[model samples]
Target: MRVVLDAMGGDNAPQVPVRGAVQAAKELGVEVILTGKRELIEDELSKYSYSGNLIKVVDAPESISMDEQPSKALKKKNSSVHVGMSLIKNKEADAFVSAGNTGAVMAISVFSLGRLKGVERPAISTVLPNLKGHTFLLDVGANVDCKPHHLLQFAVMGEAYAKYVLGDENPRIGLLNIGEEETKGNELTKEAYKLLKKASEKGLNFVGNAEGRDIYSGDFDVIVCDGFVGNVALKLSESLAKILAKILKEEIENHFISRLGAITLKPAIKSFKKRIDYAEWGGAPLLGVKAPVIISHGSSNAKAIKNAIKVACQFAESNLNSYIEKNIEKYG
Candidate 1:
């Protein structure tokens, strides 16, 4: 499969992304097209050892920075992120991967690739690691304000990801709300609950409302919420994990006995970090788009970038767009 990557997207820019492209090409056995300032990307790439032909570089002179306005930056046709996305629209690449500005990525993707037929809005579905396995949360930061039907569509898309990508045969769908009752949440969620119930008739495994505490408990495989709530939940979960790790280390250092205990539990701690680390999942997919697009964290490292490409390859291979389009029509 051919994957196009924005070599200038992440915090470390060409360095990390270049290494990732090489890794994906060498280890994943896939063709990688890196779009960015050609000189810079090549300079970073020269430091790595890989097959000369597996990776290709496309020159995109401009780059959109994090602080720039997403809508405005998208106007730069030569920007690396925009160019990377365009590669998919032109059918030159199977998927696009970026660790750039989230807003710009979303905006450029919609403008370039458009939404899947019958999909009103494209939602960002993030894979959150949980005890049983993992949970797929949608609209993480895409549409802050949403209508009732939008949530229903998000549920449908989330369910598809859970089943196809996560390997769940029948994924349970839940609405993120304050209470588990059907009568809970604002007007939007309340109405969405009714729509989801209707969808269950068409084969959706619609579960009841999922409280915030249920997020990591793995009680539900897919959780639907507006971008505002989902973004807050995602950020809070990420911060809490970091803080908890720091607290654990501090507690261990406070006592010699605790330090000795930590040494015995070091293996467990590493496993725990791997479970919650965003790098492990690579990046989140922007569902409901015309083409497969993977968006990684802005602070992604080489491993994260490489894994994001792997995810892009998986997405392209799944033919997820065809299934999503059919599912939307089934319920539309």
Candidate 2:
């Protein structure tokens, strides 16, 4: 399978992405097409030794910056984001992975690949490590403002992903709300609750509402919310994980006894760190698009980019969009 990497999109552009692409081609055994200035990409690629045919380069003179407006960025047809997306639109590549501007990637994807037949809006689905393995959350930052039907669509898309990709059977779906009661949230979620409950009859396992504390409890397999709330939750959780790790390290160093204990528990600590590392999952898939588009963090490293490529490959191989389309027909 072929995967396109936006080599110039991330914070450590060209270098990190190029290294990651090479690693993916070597380790994952997939052809990688790096999109960026040909000279820059080739320069970084020369640092690594690999099979000539496994990695290719496409020149995209322009690049969309993280701070650029999505609408304005799209006007640059030669931008890396646009070119990479176009490759997928033309079927030259199976999937596109970018660690660039999230808004630009999403906008370019919708513009180039279009949306699924019945999809009103595309949602970003992220898998977070939870007590029971993991939890799938949707609308992590795609649509800040959504109507009741949009949340229903998010639930349907989230459910399809959890069941097919994550291997969850009858995935428990929940609406992110303040309280567990049916009428707990604002009009959007309250109205969305009724729609989700009704959808439960059509095959969705809508399990009432999910409070903030239940997110990592793993009680629910999938949680749907507006982008505003979901994004805040995602960022806050990430920060908390980092701060907790730092605090633990500081405490361990503060006392000689604690430092000695840390050495004995090093393996466990390492395992815990791995569980919360964002690089493990690499990227989040933008559902509802015609083709598989994986969006990585803007600050992604080589490992993250490589894993993102793996996710794209898996997403494409699963024929996930077809399953989502079928479910949308059933639940919409």
Candidate 3:
């Protein structure tokens, strides 16, 4: 499979992304096209030894900064974000991967690749550690404001990802709300609840509302919410993980007995950390787009970038967009 990487997208830029491309080409056995300043890309690439054809570089003179406005950043046609996304639109690449500005990535993807047939808005689906392996959450930061039907669309797309990519034969879908009761939540959830119920008749494994505590409980395979709520939940979960780790470290160092105990439990601690690490999952997929588009964190390292490429390859191989289109038509 051919995957395009935005060489200048992350905080580490060409350095980290270039190293990642080389690793992916060598280890994953996939063709990687790196888009960015050709000179810098080659300079970093030269530091690594790999097969010539497996890794290629495309010159994209401009780059969108992490803080740049999405709409304004798109004007730079030569930017890495635009160039990488264009490669997908042109079918030169099977998927596009970027660690750049999230907004710019979403905007450029929609403008270049367009939406999948019957898709009203594209949602960002993030994979998080859950009790039963992992769960998918949608609209993580794509559309801050959404109507009732939009939530229904998110549920459909989320279900597609769970079934196709995650290999779930029947993924449980839940509306993220304050309570499990059907009567709970605002007008959006109330109305969305009815819509999801109707969709369940069409074969969706629609579960009732999922409360905040249910997120990591693994009771639901996929949770649907507006971008505003999803984003807040995502960030809060991240912060909670970090703070908990920090508190553990401080306590471990506070007493000699605790430090000794930590040493004995080192392996378990390491395993726990790996479960929460974002790099393990690589990145979030922007669902509802014409082709696979994986968006990684701006602070992604080489491992994260390489894994993101793997995810892009998986997405491309899954033919997920086609399934999403069919599901939308089936449930709409």
Candidate 4:
């Protein structure tokens, strides 16, 4: 299958994207189309040893920066983000991956490709490595304000994603709230609780509300929240993971005995780091879209980009959109 990447959208730009695209083409056996300035992409690409024929470049002279407003950037027809979306819209590519501006990607995607047939609004489903295995959360920074119906749709989409992409048989769905009780949250969560319970009676394996502490507790397979709360949770987790890792490193260096202990625990520490690394998942899948599009981290490295391609390929192979539409209709 063919996958298109926004080569000039990330922090490292053409280099990381080019290297990742080549690695993906070689390792994943998928054709990659890099969209950006032809010369810059070629220059970076020439630095690597790859199957030249498997990787192609489509010239997109302009690029949308991370700081640019999503609404304003959408008007740039020649931007890499725009061009990449067009390729997907035209069916020239199976999926598109980018580590560029998140807002721009989401905005352009909805305007260019439209949402799935019964989807109220598309949500970003981000998978985090939990103690048991993993937990999928949405709408992470997509829709700031949402209705009760929107949260239900997020639950439905999250469960479908857990089954298809993450390979969970019966993923438990939970609403992120102040407390686990039905009477717990603001008006939004309280109303959504009843709807989710009703949905559970239908087909969903809806578990009750999930507190913030329960996020990494691994009790819930999929957690649903409005974009505001979800984004805060996501940011806090990412920051805490990095800070804790740094603190451990410093503490190990401060004491000789601690250093010796660290050496003994080196294997476990390495394994723990691998589990929480965002690079491993590559990117978050923009669930509820018409096709697959992975939104990678802005600071993504070559490894992250390659893994993002793997995710895009997996998404393309799954009947995700159709499954979501069918499930939404059941609830409708």
Task: Give all candidates' CA lDDT scores.
Answer: 0.89, 0.91, 0.91, 0.91
Where does candidate 1 clash, by residue pair? none
Model 2: residue 175 alpha-carbon error in angstroms: 0.8
lDDT of 4 by residue, 208-284 (tens): 99999988999999999999999999999999988988997898899999888887897997888798888998899
Q: Could you tell which candidate, 1 or 4, scores higher by lDDT?
A: 4
Note each model's CA RMSD in angstroms.
1.1, 1.3, 1.0, 1.2
Q: How many Å off is the CA of 230 in candidate 2? A: 0.2
In candidate 2, stretches whose alpha carbon ends up further than 4 angstroms from where it belongs are none
Query: In model 4, what are the clashing residue pairs, if there are any?
Result: none
Question: Compared with the true structure, what per-residue lDDT tens digits does model 3 show for residues 1-332?
Answer: 99999999989998999998998988899899999999999989888877568998989999789999998997999999888877877888999999989999999999999999999999998999986788899999999999999999999999888888877788999999999899999989999999999999988889899999988998999999999999999999999989998998998899899888887898998998888888998999999999889999999999999999998898899967888898899998
| Residue 198 lDDT (model 3) | 97
Candidate 2, residues 108-220: lDDT per residue as tens digits? 99999999989999999899989878899999999999999899999988887887777888899999999999979999999999999888887789998999987899999
Clashing pairs in model 3?
none
In candidate 1, how many Å is residue 19 off? 0.8
**Worst window of 10 by summed lDDT in candidate 3:** 43-52
TM-score of model 3 vs. true structure: 0.98
TM-score of each: 0.97, 0.97, 0.98, 0.97
Error of 3 at 239 (Å): 0.8
Runs with alpha carbons beyond 4 Å of true place in candidate 1: none
